[model samples]
Target: MAVDQLAPPPAVPGIPLLGNALPMMGDVQGFLVDTYRRMGPVFQVRALNQSFVIMAGESANRFLIEHGEAVFTSAESFGGLDQQFNMRVHVLRGRPHRHLRKQLAAGVSRDLLAARWDDVMAVTDRTLRSWEGDPALPVVDRFQRLAADQLSIAFTGASSAARFEQLRSAFELVLDATITGKWPRAVLRWPAHRRARAEILAFAREALEQRAQHPTGGPADLLDRALAATDENGQPYPPEVRAGMALQGYFAGINTVAYLYSFMLYALLRHPEVLDRVRAEVDAGGPLTFERLRDMPALHGLVLETLRVYPPAPGSARTVTKAFDFEGFRIEQGRRVIVAASVPHLLPEHFPEPERFDIDRDFAAARKASVYAPFSVGGHTCLGAGMTEVLAVATMATLVRRLTVELPRPERPLRITATPGPNPGKRFKVAVSSRQEQADYST
Candidate 1:
């Protein structure tokens, strides 16, 4: 078979069964990019005794995600997500999945999100003001705190949201356990691992039980509504299912949101001019309100650009359930195909001057043409993307309006920490004030 006709197996030429596993396992993105450079966009790699074809570039990714939905299954892509959380329904494929997705979408409509802006901004303002005195706090942790708090408010009303501190500790343990477990040979039964897992389960159990028994009315947060949802047959979810949904809320909401906020802060620090430009746009609108925020294009560009440059979850994969042929090589059933997001995100075809960070570059036109998809694509596209974006924009816009921020020095070029994230060690110190020095710049 000609290599050009079918997808070539990700190029793994040497080493037997566990070919390229050791090197690739530790740094998946780095290994994928390196392999692509050494071979081509598509190549074969063996990890854990399995030979899987990895795809790169925008067209390849689109073929796998958008066009080849039947061949590649998200259930396989996010395999252990169920093991980590109880909300198996949300991640499940087919009828139940579609129904739940529709319900979630209905609940989180644009109008609902707009109505929640007051609460979102209130949480953001309070959180930012709390960090006023600290001129040198690590932005990652700070952003994590802010995001977690906002999520707490967004999901569980203001009065109930005060428990975010407790939730944060639980979430941290969950993230630590999950990330560590994903690494090879890390025993989940280890004492530290067991303890972390227990913390997560305990937190989920309490939150679910509390929300289930005592329901809050008026703009249902994720928790209250999830607890109220019925299965496909119009029956209440089983106890396990209910517990699963609650756990999913915590897992889905915290770490990813933290990553988004952290990346946004990293972008602001790295690109001072962009930050200043965004601040100018916000300042020209006068007082920070939900109405003005939705109109700020520069801030919108900042959010969009940040995600394009440093996506929180850099790669999303799907496994082949059926045998298929691509670029000439036979892709056997059950093999995984990883979409290399970090590389594709930088593809010059999709994003011109892919290496450069420029917000002025017109993405709206390209996005409409299916050139950009940071949230991943197809049925498995992120459900919380809309909420996360609104939160990021709201928080960032408020900070710019109410605060004067200055990076002591330009942030170092971000380095990958956990495959798809910026390591927090490279902290950028920024002096922040409650009031502006001068309103010289205007949008």
Candidate 2:
């Protein structure tokens, strides 16, 4: 129903200027969940000088998925996100946005992964193999690097793996700041972050130069796709321009895949019975392929369950360009709208025994019902989402098949740190053993 009245949505009472920024920053997901529950689906939350109209639950998800493009654009909502870098697809709208997204789409697509399957497994096998050497493992660090290496393999080719390994900290810092916004923008001024900025630009330049040096018709990665760009003038843009534009492709996740992997491991280690079931499922599957991996019910279920319990970046924010009305409340133009997608994940109506982490639950059906959007919805749905699904299932299966991992304190509940998004905290370290060593102990 359209409302001509200028009455805003119910306000979430907060302090005058700073508003709810402190609590919002402290636990963004928790704040969102609580506010949604308390204030109902549509409410206004102010943070600092900003006031955001938060739309929660399945209704919000559908609204964004269906009508988001017409009413919202991310440019202002995510202003200054580009920072030192020039343009990013996340902030663009209309033709320019679609153009860049199309270019980025193919490189990160599932098809490219299938085409480069050998390198994908090699990187996976090598990374997991490295984990066995670490007696006291920080799965977060290892998974963070693994994600970067995987992106390198997917984009710049496997030869850049060593280069990526050397630049791991740079990627971590850059992605942590850029993709996740976990660190305040001030953190970018640090000496180390400056070095990180240099390293990323250097990495981009080196990848471009190497491509030129040996122009083999290899499977086009994201970098290749980015370099393929031509301006509206129909002339190729300058190297520096393309490199800046292509920087987003190098993302390895601060809170995205990095934390997702950590949480998956945390969940599995927490539930030994589920871990054993997954291990058995992995064992029964002779050779793991995407299709074969999906056939492994327990493994698939574990992956899905992990996502439900610990979504890395659960909410997507957009700025309203044109005013719109929803549920009798009029959200004005220039308002910031946060689609609180995580709310439905824990809603008892959708998820029975909402707090329990059970593999038997059907989150896919929940997702089908528009209540679970782990990768989010609308024009800006995550590009790497499909790749993440395959990586999650494949990496978890591979980890269980080749190695055994144990938490230091298995009985202790997980403590989360929002490095801008939900992540398993520092205490979630693990002890690793090769499967052969484990078997020897059994023998």
Candidate 3:
């Protein structure tokens, strides 16, 4: 097949060097959607001397995720991540990627998570209690802190307040750098990034040393488990490898979980009816156990709906490795292919009235059809998906049951930031009161 004979997907023309870089940084989802409307599901857009072939909608999603490995590679797609951090599972490819994912999955396995249920509840309760005196608390900030503390406990066994702050700051910098794809040329030479990385590494090294000396009777936390993990050949991972894996897991859980918790709250507050139904389910169910969380259809639906509407990570990219024809267009090898959750989640074909937040929507069918991939799809699906859902449901149930949340500005829309994740730009303040206080006032 002659390369010239094959047609390239439509490309959005832009400046000579920068191309659509500015627009992409400004409004990534909007830019991709607009281009999709104009050029259909498969089109190309140039950004900073590179061209990306974006594939949207259900078919596009299936092709990009399920069948991606055959024609695409994750390492090349996420190459920029190397500049920020060591090669984590997300940025690894082929056999190494599979091995790393398998090792990491042990940390978030259903049984492991169930064992730590009490720890999760305790942290969440502590966080909520600390906010009791404040009449109006910023939901995002509070949740971010809560998530950092919870993850620190689950991943590292224990973390001081100072360590938690350091981890949060470091994760934020790495996340921002990866999303923007414009890190300072010197990379870790920047004082803040350098300091943050050093702190994270120091913490990881200290935790590893402690685990090695004590050899906790049982796996105390994810770090301990990773340290003791052996590959298929029964070879233990090096100390640095274990530390890097632990740090990567910590970074992954912190920001993503925080944003997910915030979005779930935002969605529930905006829809009081849904909130009431979820609370009723929680009350009737009694005790927010893992089983109870799974049993409550309303609460489960709300979490799924929140993810569908405001996915923490909106889109993912892959680098084409083999020439393939997709939907009548011939895509050449070495092109960057993007599959956006925002696109399929908002498609009228997959989701009728896609923008509307309806918990009762038929997500089961949509998921089976590959239209709703909030945690992503295919070979690289997030290992933390199950854990995040469980924790979010449990936390939200506790919130509704113990306290009443009142949005100070119900009329104001929930605005998201420009980053790939569903981070809110404005602070979400809710005038919260105890359920007992509300009951007494009503009487």
Q: All candidates' TM-scores?
A: 0.82, 0.87, 0.89
Ranked candidates (TM-score, high to low): 3, 2, 1
| Candidate 3 per-residue C-alpha lDDT over 367-416 given as tens digits, one digit per residue, 9 for 90 to 100 | 78777888878878878888788878888888877777788888887666
Task: Report the lDDT tens digits of candidate 2 across residue range 363-428.
Answer: 667877878777787778777877888778888888888898887677787666665567776667
Instruction: State the RMSD for candidate 3.
Output: 3.5
Model 1: per-residue Cα lDDT over 157-269, one tens digit each:
54334555555654444444443223432454568656765666676668767876877657776666667789789998766666666554554556667777777767777
Against the true structure, candidate 3 has what lDDT?
Answer: 0.72
Positional deviation of residue 394's Cα in model 3 after best superposition, in angstroms: 0.5
Candidate 2 deviant stretches above 4 angstroms: 1-4, 13-27, 46-51, 77-83, 133-135, 159-195, 231-241, 252-254, 437-443
Cα RMSD for candidates in order: 4.3, 3.7, 3.5
